[model samples]
Target: MKAAVIGLGVEGKKALNSLLKYGWEVYATDLNVNINLDNLPISLSSVDISPQNDKISFVKDNLSIDLGFNNQEKIDSCDAVVLSPSIWGSKIAEHYKNSGKLLCDVKTKHRDIFTIGVTGTNGKTTTVSMIKEILENAGKNVLVGGNAGGGFEGYYDLILEADKQDYDFLLVEVCDMTVGFCNHCFDFDLIALTNMGNDHMDVHGSMEGYKNSLKEFFADKIIFINNNQEYKEEFRELSRLAIEYSKTDYDLDLFGKFNKLNAGLSEAITNFISENTFEIDEKIIKNTLKNFKPVEGRLEVLKLNDCEIYIGKSDNSDAIKAILEEVDFAAVFIGTPRHNENHRLDILNEVVNANPEAIILFPGLEDTLDQAKFRLHALDYQGRIEIANNLDEIIGFVAEFSHNPSILIGGNGQENIIKIQDRLKEICDSFNHKENRLLFED
Candidate 1:
């Protein structure tokens, strides 16, 4: 069989590797010029469906890269095209579809793989990680990933590694941005929409676009939804098997009611998994999750002497809102403004509304002074808010302000989060409190 793997992002690369192992003649294409093809025949352009040698290879030909969509003629000639979820559901994709030829998805297909997709405005990564730990404790082969940044390919990488042995179940944390890119997925065996909130409406355009995306996922697969009146339509659609994810809850290793909702969904889905040949151990799930260590950099708690630190997902509006709304934090650290207007506007609004005694740290990207000023002006904060983006300068600021401050390290969209994580941890360590509590939905 010949495979035409589209896009070289994490998912596409995994799908391509899978195909290669299956002994299929694979022709990989990508718009990104930075794809490392050290051991693979990844060509630069989406020239055609046929596999070419070094002559057409971007690395060999040394052609100037063009970061654009794939070429159509090649798309038409493919035996089977493996699509990344990033492909937008527009007429372009519609035209690319050939019913007779296979249109497969790297992250989707084979619901038998068994998945628990955690969805919502926030708390997706943390809850998903809890489920993953619970499963790992239960000795189930599970991989988790989706919209919370690194969760993008993180679990898929885990899955590939587990492939050397044999893995059974997969847990995925999905975001509207990634999930919204594709209207439907054939891979989800079960789903958990944590709780809906205001986010990404700029791209989704309106409430309708956002709601419809959920509609499509439930329409395509067996789903479990948050017990809120807001998604009455979604509930109506899945009335056949609707289960309330968040209602009366217990104290959880995770943060708030939002996290409880995320965990509840995972519980229901795991129960479903139990119904099969394997009987899932409830005790294991509860125990594993009791001390479930959250991922680094997400709502990570950094302790700087006599205080528990609260770092955040840098950009996840829901996670930020949750901590702000629920936790009685000592203080909150807010990141500075960015080029992305929507992010700068929305995040600042969320931060200011949280109104925690706030100290702002700036990443200081080029060309955002005016936008930053405009955003700061728009939000009226009830808490102390200051701006300092310089690394060394912020280090000094943290030293003085580190006492009992709930450090909220927001994930990057405005600034590179990986870099932010490093800096925040370094400062936390300096205070001799290396306790970082990460909160996310993977």
Candidate 2:
């Protein structure tokens, strides 16, 4: 058997590795040919493509490797084509489909795997991570990946690696975009929805469309859903084993009522798995819940001098509202990559209504701080509004002006977030190491 793996982003690389491990002659392609393989996620780095030798080749930036086969010819010669979620609707995918080649996505290839797929607009990474942790505490050999770091780079990679390993269970973070592309391919043994909200409409087109994509993928699966989510009733007809979960009080290291609810969902899923698959001691599960730490970049708190800074990557109105509801902020610094502007404006309006001491907006690639400033002004907000030149300027301003300030840094740019996080941690560490102020003598 032969396979063609398209798009060498995280997921595509995983597919390439999986195909090779399964002993299929593989060919790969990426629009970006100049990627340094060493800099990729840890999972991709371990993929051994060396064994396939001359049978395996890559097309980079429209140029074929010296392997003596053109890109299109290699793709056409493959028995099956595996597409990453990013390239689901691309012209290349369309071409392969038209050629009558068997086209499948990362999820579909592992349809028979005993999988727990989690999907929602928010809290997906946290919830999935919790599930993985709880199951591991129960002494189950588990593989957790998809959209976040735990096992591999992407779902494709995770599934591929899981196939080779002796994992007792698989936990996957399923994105709505992935559902939109490979809904037909999903065969989850158990599924979960954290909470559905208005998000990714730019890709899904409309609110109804986004909901339907989830509805279709989750239909006929053993499902768990949030009882408090909007449109909860709509999901009732989608599955026969649909179970609804509500908020539960648990002594947890994480903050926010939403996180408490996430813990509840994780507990419920763990219980369900224990009941259906294997025996899990309730004591161990409880201990794990009590000790579970907050997922990184989701309301991560850093104390500097007299200020308390909360940094997260929350880019939607609902998530922002949840953060503002939980913390009494003196100031907020927000930066987001270009996304649905009108939706962001609505979220910003809610931020204004929260009425912090100051609002700092930073420019993303597509949207400017000036645009956000205008929106806040139009909302009749009378509080201080400032435009941040950079993440450092925002951090410096917050440290200088406000006492006990709550600095919120969020956006869609993961690279920028990592940089900001590193700088923030460095500043906090430096402050911690400084000598205490002398009360009376110097």
Candidate 3:
């Protein structure tokens, strides 16, 4: 038997690795008619085993990937064409499959290797990382990799590596895009939704559209969601295992009420697997929470001088809103307003309301929030509503307000976070606040 994998992105390499291990001759290709092998994720071993080298070919060169898949010659030689999720129902995908190339998807592993997908607007990566770390610490032999794209391969590799003695579990942080869901539909055994929020509308368009994308992918398995009005009303009778988690149920260590719910969902899933008696160690679960560090760019507290916080989250509006709730800031500086201006404004309004004394600063955000200050007008924001276009200016401003009880750096890119932290160290050294005060020292 032969397998053909297309689109040499993160998932492509994973599919290739799996097909090769199954002892099937595999051939792969991508839209990169011009991209070198180095640029593609495939290894030399996968290419050599390709049916293409054996006079039969696996991949067809569909010049443009976004539109129709036009190349049919490449699809004619394969016994089966493993469609990468990125390839939609374009003319090429339709034509290639019309030739009766057996159709299979990543979801085929439901038989022996049951799987779960973690999806949400934020914290999905960290939550997935925590789960993987916990599983590994318990020596459960697991694989964790997904949209964070941090080098973790897919189940195809894990299935081959199982060897009846090695790895057994898989944790994937699936993306919130249609392409992400289509791929997940065929790749895994079970699915988990970390939580849903108003995000990715630029790509998914409407809230209903994004939620439908979530529902379509995992319509068969369990979906773990929050006990919110929207989710409850929309998925009223969705058939699959519907689970809800909250602090009223568990004392999850993850920060925030939302994060506590993340813990709840993780616990629910862990408990389900535990019922099957998977031999997961209690120590592993504890270690996963205690040792796992939040990703660098996501709510990572940079400095904690005088209860002040400099935080970072991947330049998404939803993340900023989450961070605002997690900590108190006397002033808020956002590095970039990359998405959802209205959402970012909501975050600013909430932060200002939550911390009455907080001064709001939009250093590099420009006129995105021309909506102006809601509570404290710009003139009213003396040390607070300050704007600096350059890192030097922002750092100097941070030093100026180093006296404030607290300051927050919102957005993942705190271009001024590190520099300001270093400056604080100098001031602390000169003033000798070590004896009088400190960030967490008190």
Candidate 4:
């Protein structure tokens, strides 16, 4: 038997292992033409297998590698083509589907362990982390990881590891990009959504398409979603088990109203899990909630001298609006990679409406500064606009010139936040630096 795996991302690597385990001659390919594995001809060993699987090695004899393009004819020759979650909606996946080839995603064999799936446009990582903390504090063994994707192992890796360990619960963070495939790949015992928003419209194609995907993915699954979610009414009729949750009064260490909603959802799930299975103390849940700090990339607060700066990932208008609701910022900086393809220019209107005193544009995937200036000009925004050379420039301006400025930094992930923090530290370390009390003291 022969099989091909397309898109050598996390899920694709998992597919390779499974196909090789089944004794199939596998042809692997990735779209990144610059993979540079000895100019494309490479062995299966070239891929990074998780240390957990170091003991279980694959037979290299049946593996053939190709990078850059997915040769339709070559893949069609295989009995099946397994796609990575990242490649789900691509032309290659569509081609395989219609080419009479058995097209599928990396599938997890049914396991008896109780599984919980967390998903939404945002708040997935925070909610997943909260759930893990609560579960662990309650003395339950848990294996947690999924589309959390911010320097965490992919869900495919976690699921495989879960099979080897005797875990009480398997927590998976499902992103919209992977939600459709997750429906077929994971047998989730329960699913929880923080909230829905206008996100990933480009990947899903349209708002209706995005909503439909969520509806279908949540159908036949026990789900907990925000009561105010747009699809709440429809989900009640579609989901096999649907429960609506609202904001809670739990004293969370995290910031923002959205975090409160996430806490509420996590609390509801933990309470239900306790009632049905292993009992968790109310005190433990409260303590866990109280001690659970905000995830690094979501509404993370920092200090530059007396100025308060808040940073988080804001890709869509809904997220930006949500942040603006909780943060009273005098200045806001926004950036996004491939801004045009990722979203429309209208998203900038939200920031304008928020009426920040000043707006700064930082370089991102493209000329976001110029693009944003054009949009702001079109919108006739009244705020002062400036271009920042880097995060260092923004930090210096806020620290030296501003009067305890409240700043909001948007449109970067956790990795970028770390880089920004490093740059801030370097600035503080310099002799020509503004002052002490730079960041992270409190």
RMSD of each predicted structure: 7.0, 6.1, 8.0, 7.0
lDDT of 2 at 366: 52
Task: Give the least accurate 10-residue stretch of model 3, judged by summed lDDT.
Answer: 61-70
Candidate 1, 1-442: lDDT as tens digits: 5656677665666666666665556656776655655434445353332334322233222111123345556555656666665675655445445353434333233344766677767667766877787677778777555552544543333333444445577676776766744324436666677777666666677667888777766664666776674876655674445656554254565555655666676677667667764787878766665566656556556566665656556454655666677666545555543465455346666666656565464653343544655665666555565666566655565665566535565634433544565786776675453233222321
Per-residue lDDT of candidate 4, residues 1-442 (tens digit): 7887777765676556656655668888776644434322235555533222212212246776655455667777887667788766677666765665533333243356788999888788888889999998888888877673544566555654654568888888898878866776577889998877777777778767888888888888889988888868788788898888888797777778888898899999998888888789998888899888877666776666556677777767888888887767888877645655546444578889988888877765455577778888988999898887676776665664345557887764455656665565465457224443444353
Q: What is the per-residue lDDT of model 3 for residues 1-442, given as tens digits with 9 covering 90 to 100?
A: 5666666655666666666656666666665543334533345454332233223223322211211222455445657776554565566567655555534332234334456678777767767766666666666767665552333465344434443343477676676763343353335555666666665566667878877776566565666666762655455466367766543244443456656656656666676676664766665565456555655444544333454555544345455566666666667765545334444444454455555354544533344434545434633443346556566776666666666676676642333444444565565566555655665576
Local lDDT at 195 for model 1: 70
Candidate 1 structure lDDT:
0.58
Report the CA-based lDDT of candidate 3 relative to the real structure: 0.55
- The TM-score ranking, best first, is 2, 4, 1, 3
Candidate 1: RMSD over Cα atoms?
7.0
For model 2, what is the C-alpha lDDT against the true structure? 0.70
* Model 3 RMSD, rounded to 1 decimal: 8.0
Looking at model 3, the pairs that clash are 26-50, 69-92, 106-186, 106-187, 107-186, 107-187, 304-439, 313-412
Model 2, span 1-442: residue lDDT tens: 7677777666666666566656666766655545445442233343433224344443332223223223777777777777777777678667765665634442243665678888888888888888888888877887777763222466656655654667677778887778755454445788888877666767778888888777778777788988776667777786878887876567887767888878888888988978988878988878888888766666677888777777766767877788888777778777755645556555686678789888877764355666677788899888888877877786677676535656666644445556677788888888776635443346
Model 3 residue 125 CA deviation (Å) reads 1.0
Model 1: per-residue Cα lDDT at residue 239: 41
Return the TM-score for each candidate structure: 0.75, 0.80, 0.65, 0.79
lDDT comparing candidate 4 with the true structure: 0.72
Q: Residue 152's C-alpha lDDT in candidate 3?
A: 47
